[model samples]
Target: MPDTALPPTIPTAPVTPAILESLRAIVGDKGLIADDQGKQPFVTDWRGSIVGNAAVVVRPANVEEVSKVVKLCHDNGIAIVPQAGNTGLMGGATPWPSHTGIVLSVGRMNKVLNVDPVGYSMTVEAGCVLQTLQETAASHDRFFPLFLGAQGSCMIGGNLSTNAGGVQVLRYGNARNLVMGLEVVLPNGDIWNGLRALKKDNTGYDLKHLFMGAEGTLGIITKAVLKLWPAAKDVATAWLAIRDPQAAIEILSEAHGASEDNVGSCELMSRTCTDMVLRNIPGTQDPLKADTEWFLLLEWTSARPKAEGAEGMAEKMEQFLADQMEAGRVIDAVIAQSEAQARNMWVIRESVAPASRAEGPGLSYDISVSISKVPEFIERGLKAALDILPSIRPYPLGHIGDGNIHFSFMGPKGMDRETLKQYSPAITRAVNDLVTSLDGSISAEHGIGIDKLDELSHYRSRIELDTMRTIKRALDPKNIMNPGKVLRI
Candidate 1:
């Protein structure tokens, strides 16, 4: 949880009756959501923890409407919160309590403009759902590697804005890496069209990257040209009971050579997290019932189709697991023999967030350190957090291959929300301090939305913060583009 308090420095100019009429003219009544009841879902975050207020919810049907609407807000000095699917864990899309402007939602612009299988790329609107894009890629015999738990509801715009990373990051990369170009709506209502599909352009500074991870503080991403790849024909998914985090790392380290450079994902899960999912999320079964605290979900993929007589991913994975067991790193493991079995294994991993929500009040940190330092950081971090609240239960898991951990904890057995919050400050400081000492990041996959606003200022250097503020000021002079986000300017 983060401090939901808004700073007094942000623009709070209310959208008067005159401006409302102008907005309606630009997007029409169908695009405008003014009533409080219809605006609740847009104002609140996905967690339902951070409820905010907005003058209206504006859903633009196209980039032209988006441009005109932003121009109106700019003329009136009204703050705007550009939203996509509103599925971000961080409160980036949600407006503040003092927000008196509008939420510019691009959900109405969902469209796949083009798909070029030979070029290995696709042009899409920002509002396109992640799973929809993945399926679109599959239809053309290509693959979109960005896969996340929120893919069903999360939009491509938010994913790229936050530079989201998921299971496939180990093989492909982050959301930013997937994008080749972008079309943005500037704060002053001018459109900066950089939506090119070229593989390389040495013309000048690559401006597309400036907004991809800016979390909408810079501008709104309306369209993107995303890079695609050959669809996987041979893939393997496995569940393993590992000795510990260190063992998990060792297994992954050797897996690169053993899998012939086809490691897709390597996720580490604690028994507490797995059991929590099983208890809350239905139809999710335990893949392997081993007497261990830590488990690893390993996957391997290849573009080449498997021949009838040739050994496939399963055979190779079997031999590798056998070698790991002989080395005493792997306690026990199970390879998914069918697609249904693979899906079951993945359900256990992806259902963690919702399951945690159902369990109760908790804290989760998306932090990352060097691949080699993950074990040490986890060890010290657990001790530091436990020292403050000995009764708190820890649920630690991560993309171990990328050194990013969702270090989390549920409140003490019967402790209430307020009670848990009392110790949050101390516990948060202890965990974050340890991460800093190890030269790790406090916010990894999750961006510096309102949740990490203060944390970013506290952890980042003065020079770095100053440089970021300079960029924010240059791009959004009126401070109306997601004000009080990413930077204080």
Candidate 2:
């Protein structure tokens, strides 16, 4: 839990009638939602774990409107929380329960401004849904490889803001690598037009990176220029049953070696995660026949189309799996015979989240370590967690290819919600301690929202935390941009 207490009220930013009217004039009546019922959706997080309170919810339609809203709040000394999609796992987008500021939602500004197939880049509004961007790129015979379970609802702005990493990160990289430029609205309501779609720009101090994972503490990102890739014309997906985490890592290396680093995604899942998905999620069945302690969902993609009298990528992947099976590293494997089969195989991987939720309330930790230390960390961390509470069922799973793991655990069956909630803090501490000792991040892909402020402060050094505070203070001197987030300052 967060150590800091919520402020009773924001004394600086009083939500008076005149101030409300001023804000309404900028975004209009429909855009400014003042009723509690109308603001309900924006106040709460997607998981319902964090609930916030806001004086009003403001929807800005364009960059100019966003600037005006920010400027109005800035002049009045009011704090502003910029939100997009509201799909963040960490409480980054949620306002404090006692906060009396406005929630600036960018959902209305979603649009694809331009697509340059020749240049292999696309300019889009920050509020554009990630799935929509993927579809737009597909229409042009190009690919936007930033994909995740929440892509259907998550916005590009939030993706870039969190520097989101998905399964394709092994091949395409995270959101930071995919984005080329950004157009942000500063805290003082000034618009910085830095949206340059160039691959190489040797300029002084790349300012765009400051806000990429800042969680809106520095500025509000309103638009972005994203890099695209050639569409994958041939794809091969497989589900392999592995003996253990060590074997999974070995197979990942073997897959990369066999494919010349063409492997797109190599997802590792624990047996418990697979069982939960199979039981809770409908239409999900185990891809492999024999039971294994660990599983690896592998995929290989290539832009080259299949040609006559030539070996395809799928054939090579099958041959590689056969070789691994012969070596006894793979207990069993199933290669998707068709695209439909491939999608079905992916469904099991994607259903891990919802299925785990349906199983029971659990303590979830998103951490990362060096790729080589993954197996060791998992071994030690799981033992540490079980030692703390033997009844706890650890369900650790995630993008192990890049060392990011969603190490989560649920209480024993039939445990009440209140009892389960009591173990959260202790469980979190044990896992995080192991992660820090391994030189790993407490929050890997997830940004430090209000949820992990104390944890970050504890794990990071004085100089590191001070440098972050210095940057935050310099960019947002007033401290009105997403106040009480990232840094407690």
Candidate 3:
């Protein structure tokens, strides 16, 4: 696909009793996963995107345990694949085939170590569920602002590894920006205790960042210190039927400027996306019945305000919408009157993935470009893809505020999935070209797992590619940590 040389196959060592015994001793019964029948669930990823064959899937209880297991693996020259939540879209956490390596799942180590509300930070083990962390933060009157559709199942370690961007990324930035520090187990089993919650640490090169989005190749994240914001005391959500993509952008910018930058999320969806969700997902109704071509789901949070005048904020939002209508930017819109209504409106946006699934046999691609160029990218890319596979149905939607669009193409009528996959790469390449031509990234929120492993080498320049390789070699000289991933070592 990228004209990059495929990696020469590495010889796998026979899993001698000594190897299993060593791993078992480090983590005891709870960590080591040797029996395939029992390790079935952990072997594959959430979407069943990629499956790895780890002879054993180990679960360490703490940093000490992780270091111990990693040390043993390093000594044995056994490759290790780190997994968390298994909800990655790019098959990042997918176990390698042939059971050659060990899959180190951090699910068991899910514990909220501490929440220092005074300092506005929380330290959580890598295994902590994302949704649990969000709830725990709320209990302490603080906010852990990482939001994803998979929050209920995905782990924080995976979030950082992928540098996940969610609906709230427009406000809090991606997962990488929200993290303060991390506890990493190095490639050679050395423990780097970097779990510092300091906001300003000018000590040296920010090493935590390397492992944060490294997809477990550079190191294994054991625990982390994540930054928190003031819990949102009030929030408002609205469904706007916009005239066009440019109008959607204008409404968001205007609302953002008027609301004192309190806007949390601003997403745009075509009627096609809405139609798919309504068709597949049950208990869904269109918020607006107008023949609107596009829609925007906007959210705002006034966290610091000490009064219960959110409706006033809502009124401000109404005026913002009126401004859009006056300019003919929006045709119709509705504001949610209650939290239940807010959740209902959110359901429409979240239902996209499930709806796409129900539609069946599609290629999913999430790529990003500049905010101003998103509409262009979508329009041009969609046209190009449909030209290539004229029968394909395009489902282009996502966080337009940040220029990241989850562009999916459903298989055409009577077309089998095998046929759809044949053109998947063509679709990806066409969109990638458009994105790069516009000076944007091929990946936005999701990490380049095995799904985009080859694409990374193609999209990135030779100098950038070599630099990343050098860093990887410097950190993981043996390439035993998540081998055959992310780069062409």
Candidate 4:
């Protein structure tokens, strides 16, 4: 949405019948999908905003097959677009509109190679779904703390490539911190096996970090070694009505102090976002009897269990909320009394994206500032966004505890898609300018795929951008891996 003018197209090596047959032989007849019907899902993104055309989609079943496929593509000088789960927001995983490349999907490589409970690590194939990994950790009485709404379908490779951050980032850190090692197939088709489960490794260069958040521009992540922690035995979830963003921040501080940093997730939602969820998503109701302009969904978890007259963490959390309410920081609050009720609270948080989309077309910003500057950023950012298009409805929601906010703006009622697209650049600039002024990032958790290319170029320094291009060129000279993604070089 930066401008109507398109970037210069990158030429791709032609995909002939001989190349297709060779690819098919490497993966099986079922692995190579050439028909339009079979390739549609891989080419299109989850949000449906980006649709790409591919000569074919190759699904490799193992690391060897992945290496071979990459090698073949590299030898033929054909571009390769690595896709997994296809749950990205930046169109990083999807091919370009004029792409004449083949999509290398790792979906068939789904497998859990090893799980060491004693070492507190799990080595899994990149194609493994996030939800399945979480469940597998739970089976071993541990927890993989990457909890996103798209966990059910988002693959570990995609999560790693994007370096995804979720609600629990305040406590567990992002995907970059959670990953211990990686097995990547480089752009030139050489395999780098660095899948070590060590806690400390002071090597010459921590090469895995290069590919972890590179958005597949350097290499294809085939497998990973992830860190795990002991599962929480007791979790306390609550919904609190707050006066404003400042109050939400104050309550978060108080919760952290009271729970000794046991607060796992502290999310903020605007009144409009909550309303959209209740109206759009089924089986969702307002948990608070009284409505406020802002809401906070907070939770605390501990490995210690409450039994035999011992005070549980949940009880302490309730007491903390009670004190906060008495002090007037929290207007009203409801603590989940049962597991079902706790899940109900999470439903509202997870339903935000779908509900907002259902309401109308909107420009979303996954931007973040310092924790103390959140309120100021939101207050000024909203006013600036509305200044551009007064009728646009601002729906800001996100993990405020970690300073990331999804400040989105819903289009005015009856606004056509074309009109909305036309206004996108200005709207994005308005919000991004405010974020930059406040020392915040325009692209927080979401990587700069095709979505934020222009914004990134505008805001980032020339030296930093040049260094990134240099690294990209060094790793992928042909610019064959995920072309036109992350960087324009």
Off by over 4 Å in 1: 4-8
Best by TM-score: 1
Best by lDDT: 1
Residues 85-139 of candidate 1: C-alpha lDDT, one tens digit per residue: 9988879888888888899999999999999999999999999999999999999
The C-alpha lDDT values of all candidates are 0.92, 0.87, 0.83, 0.89
Q: Give the TM-score of candidate 3.
A: 0.96
Per-residue CA lDDT of candidate 3, range 233-329, in tens?
Answer: 7677899989888887777778778888999999998888889999998888788887877999988888866466445567778888888899999
Q: Which order, best to worst by lDDT? A: 1, 4, 2, 3
Error of 2 at 445 (Å): 0.7
Per-candidate TM-scores read 0.99, 0.97, 0.96, 0.98
Candidate numbers sorted by TM-score from highest down: 1, 4, 2, 3
lDDT for residue 119 in candidate 1, whole number 0-100: 97
Model 3 C-alpha RMSD vs. true structure (Å) is 2.0
Model 3 stretches astray by more than 4 angstroms: 1-11, 306-311
* Local distance difference test, candidate 3: 0.83
RMSD to the native, candidate 1?
1.0
